[model samples]
Target chain A: MKIKKNIPLIDQHDKNGFWGKFGGNFIPETLKKPVEDLTILFEKLRKDKKFIQERDYYFKNWLGSPTRFIKLENLTDHLDGAQIWTKVVSDLNGGAHKSLNATVHCLLAKRAGKKYIVGDTGAGYAGKMLSMAAKKFGLKCKIFMGAKDIKRQKPNCDAMRANNAEIVPVYTGSQTLVDAVSECMRYWVSNCDTTAMCVGSTVGPNIFVKICGWSTSQISKELLIQIKDEFGEIPKKLKLINCVGGGSSSFGFWNEFMHYNKKQVEFIGVEAGGPKNSKKHAAPLTYGSKIGVLHGAMQYVNQDAEGQIEETESISAGLDYPGVSPLHCFLKDTKRARYTAATDEEALNAYQLVTKFESLNPSLEPSHAFAEAIKIAPKLSKDTVLCINSCGDALKDRDILKKRLGK
Target chain B: MTVSPISLAFKKCKKEKRPALLTYTVAGDNTKKKSLEILNSISKYVDICELGFPHNTPIGDGGQIQTASYRAIKNGIKMKDIFQIVNKFKNRKNSKPLILMGYYNMICRYGENKFLNKCKQVGVNGLIVVDLPWPDNKKFAKKCKKKSVTFVQLLSPTTSKKRIKKIINDSHDMIYYISMLSTTGGKLKISPKKILENYNSIKKINKSKNIVIGFGITIKTINSLKKADGLVVGSAICNEISKSINNRQNPVTNVTNIVSLLKKRIS
Candidate 1:
């Protein structure tokens, strides 16, 4: 790792709201006016004092801000590599880092003076948090979930519905997260004036990239403070790793760190590798995919020769997306971060290991990170450090796994 | 940019003092032969013919068009099949301007240059990629221009004034103005007076002053859209095809008759 005394200045988004040619507003004329309006409004409201105070209130008071950053003694001892720490992201409401932005977006919609909110969820955390936050903020919530996801992540879907959200069952386009999100985007465009689209990831076009990035940056900011207090100072050989779907956690975890002058950390993003039985995987970055435009943002997309996005397969429904967030693409391309994948077997075994060893159940999404941690930690020196932002609870996969095992 | 066959049709319509009739149908909807025969019949009556290549997900589409796409996909309509349909339509009598309109991903999958070359080879005069909004890789449109195929853009009521000013002077002959926020078969709740007010404002900015309106347009609705340069019939015609197919009749005859009726109403 090249240790630079001067911190690498990471531009979250350029003047056109691009993360180095990764993000932009590439939508129809019907959506152009509203997206541009959102672009202008986000730039103004994100810096406003009242808007900042309002979202911060929800984060600290309701969503449980300042998640615990604890050095894992058990995992650290097992690997005997570096001092490993886990940023416990489930210490908040709705059980993940999803609440970080979901809460903020509810306040944003309230400030913009809209009534109805619509969004699609891959893992159900975003849907749950948005429904919960919108309910608390006195706003209407509607969620779109894929039919397959609705069956697998049924508990999460019921949770959102319990919060008085209208759960729309999407049976189109592979019946997965990608289809649900695409339908939601078209619905938003048709009803942009009356409804606000709550994005579940840091992907999407401009203005949205900025909005999601600013809200989730709190993860890195809190990690900075906790590390300073625990280690006395930041270490030179620290590796930051997290799993990427639409990359909310990784994007949030790395934002503030890039602003530091002494930038020597290696950031790695773990993508979902398919089950051992199948060659179909969702790791677009690892596969060296084509750079194409989808979801209004240009980034790495898992597509066929005819430019149609391919149907991705993964054990974890949340991680089974064909396109990655533009920020992750930009980061990987610039070598600011690296990316790898863990097979479904590896992640499943890692989840069981964490639950038994630490008596803690982690979601299948972040279980990929756990697998990477064990693999990377053993290769590093014991004096070095490894950190994982542990963000999901695997209760959703437990039932399916048990049924598969005939429990 | 080359003056496309579409532009020539518009010029002829301008002399006749009537709005040019633009008709649409999804290529390979049901079967290649059946859909091409429908296209052949539709071309004789309409000034501009838009042949849509079905996509897996049609975002701007309504229920009728989506069902049409599903039927086409079920009938095994691929990108190559769409061009094959156009090739057959190219030799028809009074075929008028043929525009290959569909989602951007289909063209991208076909390879932008490869797709444009295919369009040129099949005598496609223009293109209207539904999701490839302005500034979304103008590179594809530029490639189309190089092949002497006009890449038409959409300017809706929701389009910003800034964008209108930017695209009005482009060499494309006409712009598609989606009349409502609703999909193709959505109710005619769009106020004609409001559409004209917005249409005239958009026209005021354009040097060509060519604005064709579509979305929820039927024969009854054509008179309301008389102020526009041209009238586009998409879902209404697709509905006729669906109804004819449902009644165990040849959709080609039903669709062509509807096109003639729509052309009569506008003229």
Candidate 2:
């Protein structure tokens, strides 16, 4: 029940092992040796500062890092309740915190001699990002998406198609993110010899978290610099906030901040509160789950007693997963981080408020952050400035906004 | 002392100087009575019996076991019936080990403590769940230990030496090392030399626990594993049952053929 004590990051060369409950190599026996080899190689490469610098170079030059922190002056006034600030993450690539991890995965694949890749995606952003990187690297990419998602998230599907990544629409259970992940897992198990699964987020096994940890590191570094620059001093009691689905954005934002900013800063994660108190939400933090295994690692899952996956609900398709990253579960349990929820109505309101005020349309996922921030911001002193992770561009959700907001 | 099924099986294996033939049939393969017939026929020659509890999807399993699991389920083989078979088997064979093998979902539904209690009540001895690798740390293992039920560790060739050593050290009964790279009914490829070498090496590390080689093991494959303490013949026996049912032949004769052939090698 106690939080697993952290092994010194320096002494640990691989991130492909158990990270609290979140990280481990949950691959088939055939893939174990190769993935282990990849981990060993990646660990050594990651330690070399030059490799990191080169990776950062791509972020700065290609993917556009140091994403803007725009204060939502108008939205704060409109909410008439609490202040809301927008972190612009959508403009990073086509739209997301995905490009940061995608670019690094491609770079690592190139270094590790990985030529082909496969992935499971929920809303198609990560799939698009992976395809984008794969096309650039001249590698074959196959993305598995839920059949329902393929229909609903048409724009993301279009993006993946444009990148020439083969899209396999899975018609399995719930046709959401977790189903796509299961299909991807089966595919990887079958094709372990040639293809590597570019698992997104801090979920899956160690290989996944390590790949994601890079992005989290970048987010932290940027936030540190931005805090110093904007406020003329790093806010002493700032709370770092983001939405946790599979938790790459939150993990990316928190890894550096969690341990280093500990005692100084508190990390808050917002999960999708689908249909409010109904099984329809993806609130892995609150009610939607218990610790169970999915996609190779044991974590929290909204599953039946018989282990059948339950349908997950959320306003954000990306956060509409039945499972949360085990690391997040560990963090939640150990009280290292606090997890809360923002209902669909609240997230939408936050979305509309931010757009009306700041003229920047943020993804519904991040509005969960805005909603949580609204509550937390009021109690903050004038000296206290909280940083909200804006996640992806909400341009794709325009129709949703117009319908919901009567805009 | 209530001996763990694995330890008892190992003692029997050593005394007989033959590999224990462990047959895997879905609890109600064709019918519960028919499945019991196969089990009873094989019991005379086989040393241990592995009853595979069917699930909706057997990810690690191939065609034969999948078919058997499906057939068992088609005939209404609930988790409860698994213990019923074990109880019946106990009336027939007073000493031979009976092991239930499946995934964690089954345990989660049946309830860990409840499952262990049933195993003890039915005089079942051991369990080997595929999805559960960290068996030592799970509540199931602790309950099984408390109930004196042996928790068997399934090992593959790819299992690390550290893991193998830990499993050997942690295991209460015999080690069931899967011989092939694939699941049940997979084609056997390991040469006699390799099997002997692996058996010798594993035996060198842990002499107390019995080492049983399974998965893709045939009569010939089982013969090659003389260095192993026991042979767990699952897919081959299940495949034979499937063939007999499909081709309209005597399953008893096929079961007898495999059981007699394997018993000869170990003996």
* Candidate 2 per-residue lDDT over residues B1-267, each given as its tens digit: 766656766676778766666767777887788877777877777678888887644446666776787677767777667778778888873446788888665676567777788888998788887766653245567677788777877676767788778767777666777675666667776676786787778889967777777777777666666767777777777788889999998887887887887788768
For model 1, residues A237-311, the per-residue Cα lDDT tens digits are 778889988888888988878745324677889998888778678899988988776777778988876566778
Per-candidate fnat, comma-separated: 0.49, 0.13
Candidate 2 steric clashes: 11
For model 2 chain B, the run of ten residues with the poorest summed lDDT: B131-140
- Candidate 2: TM-score? 0.77
> How far out, in Å, is residue A292 in model 1?
1.5
Q: Name the runs in model 1 displaced over 4 angstroms.
A: A1-17, A259-263, A405-407, B1-3, B70-76, B108-111, B135-143, B239-249
lDDT tens digits, residue span B179-248, model 1: 8787667777768888888888877776475679888888888887887889888889888888998899
Candidate 2 per-residue lDDT, tens place, A42-111, comes to: 7788888988898888888887887887666765554453334556777686688888887887887787
Error of 2 at A389 (Å): 1.7
Which portions of model 2 miss their true places by more than 4 Å? A1-35, A190-194, A259-264, A296-298, A305-309, A374-386, A395-407, B1-96, B104-118, B134-148, B160-173, B179-267
